[model samples]
Structure formats: C-alpha cells, structure tokens
Target: MATEQKILIIEDDTFINRIYKRVFSLSGFGIELAQNGEEAMAKMESMNPAPTLIILDIMIPKISGFEVLKRLKGDVRWQKIPVIVMTNLSEKTDEEKALNLGASLYLVKSDHNPREVVLKAKELIDKQIV
Candidate 1:
C-alpha cells in the first residue's frame, strides 16, 4: 500500500543526504532532509503530517543527535514515531545508548548501503502499521 509515509533524514554530509534521498525517493518514500539538530527541530515543528520514520546521525553540529532523539521521544506529538540512528559510531556503547534513548534501531553507516537502509526502514514502518 502506498501511503503518505515519509522519511526524515538528519545527516551532516551533503553527499550522504543526496544518496539517501535518491534511494528512498526511488522506493516511493517522501524525503525530508535536515543537516543538524536545530534544523531538524525546526523541520519537525513545521511538518504537517509528521514523518513516519526518522534517520538520524548522532554526530552533527549545532546540537547532537542524542539530544534530538531525546527531545523527539519526550514530546507527546512525536513520541510514537520510530527513529533509526544511522551513524559511524560503531562502539557497542553508542548503539546501547541510542536504544536506551528510545531509538527503534541503531545502524553503523559503513555497514549498510542506502538501499539496505531503505529496506530496514520499510520493515520498521510495516511493523508499526501492523
């Protein structure tokens, strides 16, 4: 079913954002891009339907992704949304921290390509639908 589901991508690298936008777009997902936590918060505030999924990078300028994630999970409006923390932070502690902060999943950037990330996101979204 093609719903109005969209994906919000929070990444500092323009190149990575482009790649993700292309892949997710090809897969029929609407994409919103934010370069940092501040932009992300602003985007979230202005968004109408609220994104179904958020892909976040933990190490961004202005504000950290952990802080963003915490705010998202704490807010009643966005609390139920699923977040995927996709970063190069490969430390087990980092993954644990993301999960502890209520991320639905944590991914190491080098470990998954854009298409794979899309697949994982689709899977997570499907689970939410069920």
Candidate 2:
C-alpha cells in the first residue's frame, strides 16, 4: 500500500483540533497538530518530509495565521506547501489576505464539516501529486 500523506493542522481550539485529528486519521491521512503559530513553525521546521497540506486557523496565539502564511510562502523551501486557511472569520478581507499571502484555499469553519475538510485536503494533495 502507498504511504499515507501527512497533514499539519494548526488550530488552537482543542475540540476542533481533536475533530480534525480524528477525521483525517480515519480518512487514512497521517496527522500532526500545532495549537498555535509558533508551534506550527517549529513543527514545520523540524519535519523531515514536509506535510502534504496545512490546515491553518487564523486566530491562533503568538502569531496570526496570516503571518504564518506569509512566512511560509516567503521561504523557498516551504513556499510550495499547500495551505488551507480554516478559521471562524468569514470576512472577505480576511479571505483575500490569506489568498494574497499564498494560501491555497480559505474555508470558514462553520461552513465546512470535518468530512468536507478532509475531502478538500485530499483533493488538494492529489492535485499536488499530479
């Protein structure tokens, strides 16, 4: 069997993080979690094989997800990693900022269920492989 793709979920909410972990794990993707932007950056830096996708939350502690996205897209080594901005903020400006900062997709948490998020992640990862 082919190895499962890894997904890094940067969310500060314990409940939401657990949901993502369970859903992705059940969907056969390897999972990593970061509760805040600082930890997310540290994890990304240390991971040998980078994650296939990143599900980021904008309201994270320490640094905002926008800053994280900016830094990731700025670094050549990590720039190509697909980032899906998932957060409670549903404003057009926030969405635009994320996309402008190089996020692959922006999703409002209330609009998407865990299954849908997992499916989207899979689709994005598949596209990357192609």
Candidate 3:
C-alpha cells in the first residue's frame, strides 16, 4: 500500500534537496523542503499533520541543525517523530552529538546515495507504523 507518510527535508543545498525530494516521492512518500533552519522551524510548527520523518543537514543557515534537533526532541509535540541527520559532516564528534541530541540516524552525504537514504527512511517510517 502507498504510505501517507510525509518527510521534511531541511537542507541548504538546492541540488541535494531536489534529489531527496525526487527519490522519496518516487518511493511513495510525500515531501516538503525547507532551505534554511528558520524555514524548517516554521514548517514544522505550521504543518497540520506534521511530518512522519525529518532529514536534516547540520550546516543549514539561520540556525544550526543541532539546535533544531534539540528543539524538536525537547518539545512534547514533536519528540516522537524520527529525525535523520544527513550531512557532509562525517566527524565522529558530529555523529556523536547528533545522536545525543536525539537524531534517529546519521548518514554522511557522501556515504549514501539518494536511493539508499530513501530506503532507510522507508524502513524507519514502517517501523513507526508498527
């Protein structure tokens, strides 16, 4: 069955965001894009159903992804939604920090292709359903 699951992508790179949007859409998930941290926060606040998952990049402008993750995990309304940190930062400390801040998973941008990322997202969403 087609899923009604929606994914919010918070990335500053237009090309990367488009790739994710296309991959996730083709995989039967709805998609939303936020070009910066401020826009991401606004979208999260205003989205009626919220998103089933969030794919975040740490280097986003206006606010860092770590801060966004902190807010999302801290808020009761959004804490349950899974967040995947997808970024070029492959440092061990960065990964540790993201996990400590409540990211469900962390994928280095160069380590996973768009399709692989989408598959992982699908798996996470499916788990949420159960």
Candidate 4:
C-alpha cells in the first residue's frame, strides 16, 4: 500500500488541535502538531519524510503565522510545501496578507467545520495544482 499522506498542523489552541488530530486520524492522514512557530520550525527541520501539507493558524502565541510563512517561503528547501492558513481573523487584509506570503489557501475558522476543512485539504492535495 502507498504510504499515508502526512499533515502538519501549527496551532496554539489545545482543544482545536486535538479535534483536528482526531479528524485527520479518522481520515487516514498522518498528523503532526505544533503549538507555536518555534515548535513548528523544529518539527519541520527534523521531519525526514516531510509533511505533504501544513495548516497554520495566524494568531499563535510565540510567533505569528505570517512569520512562519515568511521563513518557510524564504528557504528553498521548504518553499514548495503547500500551506493553508486557518484563522479566525476574517479581515480582508489578513486574508490577502497570508496569500501574499505564499499561503496556498486561507480559511476562516468560524466559517469552516472540521470536515469541510479536511475535505478542502484533500482536494488541494489531490489536485497538485495548489
């Protein structure tokens, strides 16, 4: 069998993080969790088989999602990883900023359920079109 696709979620909210883990688990996706940008960076560096996708929250405790996106985009090795910015911040500026920073997609947390987000993620991965 082909290996399961891995997904990394960079989120600070403990409750939401656990929920996403369960959701992705049931969907046959290997999952990794990072509470903040620092942890996320460390995880990314050590991931031998890098994750196929990343879901990043904009308002994190230690470092903002924007900063993380910038770092990932700035590095050639990590630049191709597809990133989805999942945030409750629905302002137009915030959405535009994330897209400008190389986020493949921007999702509003309040607007999408767990299932919806997972489906979207799968669609993105399947397309391979970003």
lDDT string for model 3 (90-115, tens) is 89999999999999999999888788
Model 1 misplacement above 4 A: 1-3
Q: Each model's TM-score?
A: 0.96, 0.96, 0.96, 0.94
- Candidates 2 and 4 compared: the better one by TM-score is 2
Q: How do all the candidates rank in terms of lDDT, highest first? A: 1, 3, 2, 4
- lDDT per residue (tens digit) for residues 1-130 in model 2: 2766888999999989999999999988888999988999999998868888999999999998999999999999999899999999999999999999999999999898889988888888779889
- In candidate 1, how many Å is residue 87 off? 0.1
Of candidate 2, the 10-residue stretch with the lowest lDDT total is 1-10
Q: Please give, for residues 1-130, the per-residue lDDT of candidate 4 as tens digits.
A: 2877889999999988898889988899999999999999999999878888999998997878999999999999889888999999989999999999999999998888899989998888888744
Ranking by TM-score: 2, 1, 3, 4
Q: Native-vs-model 2 lDDT?
A: 0.91
lDDT at position 115, candidate 3: 89
Number of backbone collisions per candidate: 0, 0, 0, 0
